[model samples]
Target: MRILVILRQVYEQKSIQWSYEDRKLIYQRNSYNKSDLHALQWTREYKLKADALVDVLILKKEEEASEENKLANFGIQRCFRIPSNGSEKEDAAFISDLLKNESYSLILSGYETEDEHSCALLPLLSYELGIGVLTAVYQLEGKPNGQLTALRKEERGSLQEFTIQLPAAVSVTSHISKLRYHRGRSAPDFTMIEVKRQLSKPEAVRRIEAPEPNIWYADTPSEEIPQLRLLNIMGFASQSNNSNNLQKQTDHLSKAHLYFTAERLVKWLKE
Candidate 1:
């Protein structure tokens, strides 16, 4: 069996900051998405158990030398890099087109991107390829009959097990498996294939920039506003606040309380 694992580099969320003046997000550093790492772990396990040939496809805005060294630490022998257009739909279409000529029996990817928190790529690619896609997959087992069994997470902390045929795609969650690092591994030298097909340019449209909202500060203590209190607990408040007490209070709040607080905040914002 042959498998292809799709990986994407994303900016570290903790290192990102909102540029209020620029009205955009400023990125600091790039890191491998944790869920993609789990998908890679699953690929490694499948290769070991089924003796399958595995290759990785990396989608990024630009190729970097550090990617080769990082993959080497995971003992990946073969990898391919493709330039991403940064649009989820365009990337999906590009990958679907690229996979059409390939002989890969299975495709794997992370459930969602950490930076965008979007889970639309795999499904869109599968739709374009006319193949089935399984989302939130956590466990996979190969069968002797050439089919695969997969366990997926469902609502209310439930797991559903089912079988799927080859030539399908699956988006795995971070809870699937832990990535095992191979230290001191030599990097594999592979030829980089450049994709020549260009996405057709859409007609340019005029864009309008909206005025930035004024920054607001509250005179009331954070404890009086549930939303501000939640933000304080999440380390989004002013640094001068008592973080130790906030952490203690955060630890004491139940999950239900957090959920309700977030829901209320969303409603308040909409209002």
Candidate 2:
């Protein structure tokens, strides 16, 4: 029973940014920031992670001739070099070809690639391979006939243990378990070889042109109004020279009070 683990070198999260141009999320320039993690460290950490699984082997995507030998030192048993045009679809097709000649009991890949491609290959590979795909598997219990039970995570922090049959392909999520470290006895000789990749030229689906921006600015000042000011106690009063007449009017109003006539009260009583 042979297990093949697919490893890829991807850019850090910060080094890439998503832009919503058109209807899809397109990767744009890193006007954002840089990431600290590198592929070497990531692969080294996985050495510990791969150790936890039952009856499984780890491998790198063979690049040059010496890649597999170099990876062997890091405890990788076999390596698969995909073509340069290796999209997820191509990767699935390549795996299918392997299933025809070589016997691989199971294929394992990360739940998502470190780059923009995430979960794109899993379902396709599973469909093509025609086997049960157990994704995000954290723990595994190996059986005699290559059948195993894996504890996989569902939505909302839930777990479901799946009893998977042999000849399966899976995408593992990091949320499933704590990654382990690698402690190997010796490093294997790194050899270099060119593995033929299965890929074709991608078609130009759409052409995009940056639209002109609609930016405008205005320079305007707030309008100010003049306010009236108080002059003096009586200087700003009306220019009426008849002070005696004004006093007479004021005195009449001051002395005027409410006078309820008896005739009005009699009218009210009649009503």
Compose the digit string of candidate 1's lDDT tens values, residues 208-238.
3444689877554456678877776666675
**C-alpha TM-score for every candidate:** 0.69, 0.52
lDDT by residue (8-112, candidate 2, tens digit) is: 544445544445566433553221001111222233454454432212222223342222333444444444445434366776666576657656666666776
- Note the Cα lDDT for every prediction shown: 0.77, 0.50
RMSD of each: 10.0, 21.7
Task: Compute the lDDT for candidate 1.
Answer: 0.77
Backbone clash pairs for candidate 2 read 48-180, 48-181, 64-193, 65-191, 65-192, 65-193, 66-191, 66-192, 83-197
Q: Which pairs clash in the backbone of model 1? A: none
